[model samples]
Target: MSSDPLPSFPFLNPGEFRSICSSFVNRVTGYSGDLRTLGWTNVKQDYQDGSAMLIISRIIDLPQWANGEQNDEGSCLQDDIEDDDPEMLIRPSSISGTSKVEMEYHILLSPTYQVPVLHFFFKNTLYSGPNALEIVYEHLVPPAYRSDLKQVGVMGGISMTNHPISGIPVYFIHPCNTASALQTVQGKEAPTAETYLPLWLGLIGNCVGLYIPKELFASLRNNSDD
Candidate 1:
């Protein structure tokens, strides 16, 4: 007797894939008044690690602040200074760096499947408390995807506890066929807790298809000032 070859998984077109991603984000954050809202549900019960809780808790405790308020201390600024020499006076002597932090989340979706894979990187100041950001991306496989072993077949690996930069916890929803880098940072050091929180929240929102509230972003900025 001959065995039949495995059936190929249906590939999702760009429009279909975007729709699926949009639906996924809406389903996850639909309950929240704002996308930036953080609650116990956001943290998966089975995946609770203390560090993740701490980061979420701290964000919940921050006060509301606006994005462009003068009180906002994290604003990016450029300065021009002149020297005594004629050419020097015409042109600035040197460039001065300011305080700021940035976090990047990279999502890679393959042609074989619909679900998008996620990776993250963080850049912060040296004086910043912790150099890493704790991030978790969780997804419940749809019934259709679960039924097919060849299609899903352990597409992802187990979550990791520590990522580069900050020894902070890093978690993934599924493993990909090829190993990919998760978090990375190229800067003086990790960002402050306050600045880090907003960036982190934004990254989560992007993965889940939530709309981050401008007010919430402001709050993070305001808290960083203090």
Candidate 2:
């Protein structure tokens, strides 16, 4: 390994982001389970400025409870959600069991925050609307994170905004406080390139229902031992 100093905690330069994306994708591909289960791919846009984004597009069956199939009282989310409270923005929406949901996640380097920002786009088999955010809130976000996400400033909570690269409306976890969150998770010491992306995915990805399988880490350990 090169002795070059690691980038500051929670922040990665563009070059570092590309390098880590490749390493992270390769590590996940080594997973023993079906590769499609993890659904991670490293994609670099061939625009004038080559930019890479870690992409994961997958279809998930909403929980039975959220689908309003089990219980009589269906989800109370509205078709259009206004950002009245950045902290608590989810309202009841009409989503049925037949609605197919395909969620696409993009992890890109944020020039302003110097950290990776997770931008997610939701495509519904029925229709796409503000209710998409409701699906994320009700299905993807954990009960523990739902409350903290309301503290937008402190937690760098979830918000809907235009994607920087695509300029399309999408939901993303705010990256402003990412450095602070990583510090708490990773401790005071800086992590190397090999370790940084994994640590980051654990913190940020978990918020939106993305997870790195334990098998990936097991493979990493086995490789190091060899």
Candidate 3:
């Protein structure tokens, strides 16, 4: 058996994080992009200035009604919308049907929190209407978790900040209470490196619209039983 020890929940050491990230990269390979109808793609591990991270990309379709333009009345909602409120002042644009936008996600271990943090942004440059944060709130944030994610500076909120290494402005789901949040779903059993990421993605990734295929989980189960 390998000598590596399994990582503890709520926190992950650098070595353990790398091991889990590598396993995650492999699991997502050939299972995303054009290979699957609805899944992430461009999965790989990369390093910059000695830090390791996992990167993945996907194209998401937004319904025409997802537009965030203000109505002709020229009124706008207050900037201080309550954290518990998911309702937004959005109006449909002239565009019809659905529109696609390519989104990229960067998963890196946080030095302070000792947990994985997700940084993501869409790839379009010319597209304009609302800022990244506004777009995320309007189209990506699920109504179920909208309130919790609005509580910035606290757990369960989506934070808009600059990338630690790249210095690029990006949006990330807060990792502050990731451990406690994960504990609720992880149960009493210790999680293996192979299993950690899928669990993390299920609990955390969904905040920003990342979802793993159910069939992939079934495939992993079958492989483990062999």
Candidate 4:
């Protein structure tokens, strides 16, 4: 491996980061959910098998919007505070006439890290004249430096709980480390393999995001039953 230190990338503000992270979470989880509903038994396994490659590809593309590195002259930072009429703002046709809205957030990984972790944040609301919010996190795991195989994981947690505006569900996944079995050529610190696995997995599934709907939660429980 090259002796050079890993590359460094820009960091995003909390709101921007959260937005990207949420979207990623929703996409990955939604995909998983769809597969589960379709009775796909090996969805997780197949996902793991390809996650490394997918992550690397994303790293290379490094979309500006995803990382909040756009040149919009700070348009992203500005919020619509003065608008008295929500209708004044252009809304997607899909959400027209419906109070329900969904928003996405992104989290960028450190470029220098051998294994990158990206978080996707999602917000879902149901129309009821009151703003209801649901949050979810999608953790992205890229392959370790110089590794060919993809060793990705997904876990979910709850950030808040209350009413139709229940808290967000956060997901945690592991990235490659130098010292562990999924060692990286560029990593220096070796995360404790024995302890980190379960801890990471549980955190990914339990503490990161809030679970909504007993039915959805029940499905998750059953899926892990085996």
Clashes of each: 8, 7, 0, 34
Estimate, for each residue in 21-83, the C-alpha lDDT of model 1 and write its tens digit. 343343334343443344222321111221111111112211111221112233221111111
Across 1-226, the per-residue lDDT of candidate 2 in tens digits comes to 4224365656778888777777666666556667455543322322224777878666666633243322233322221123233323333355444533566788888899989899886543222245456667777888878888867744578877876777666789999888898888888777766677778878888888876657666775575345
RMSD to native for every prediction? 19.4, 6.6, 7.5, 17.1
lDDT against the true structure, per candidate, is 0.30, 0.65, 0.67, 0.26
Task: Pull out the clashing pairs in model 2.
Answer: 76-92, 76-93, 77-91, 77-92, 77-93, 78-92, 78-93
Model 3: per-residue lDDT, tens digit, 29-53? 6343443465555778998888889
lDDT tens digits, residue span 1-226, model 4: 1112212212223333233334333334644354333322221111222122111011111112222222234222122212223442322233222122222222223334433242322222111111111212122222221122122322211222211111233222333331143232224443221222222223322233211224444554443342
In candidate 1, list every pair of residues with a backbone clash: 25-208, 65-218, 65-219, 132-166, 155-175, 156-174, 156-175, 157-175
The better candidate by TM-score, 1 or 4, is: 1
Quote the lDDT for 220 in model 4: 42
The number of residue pairs in model 2 that clash at the backbone is 7
Q: Which stretches of candidate 3 lie over 4 Å from their true place?
A: 1-7, 30-34, 63-97, 126-130, 152-155
lDDT of 2 at 58: 62
Candidate 1 lDDT (Cα, 0 to 1): 0.30
Once fitted onto the true fold, the runs of candidate 2 whose alpha carbons sit more than 4 angstroms away are: 1-5, 38-48, 63-100, 124-127, 224-226
Q: How far in Å is the alpha carbon of 114 misplaced in model 3?
A: 0.5
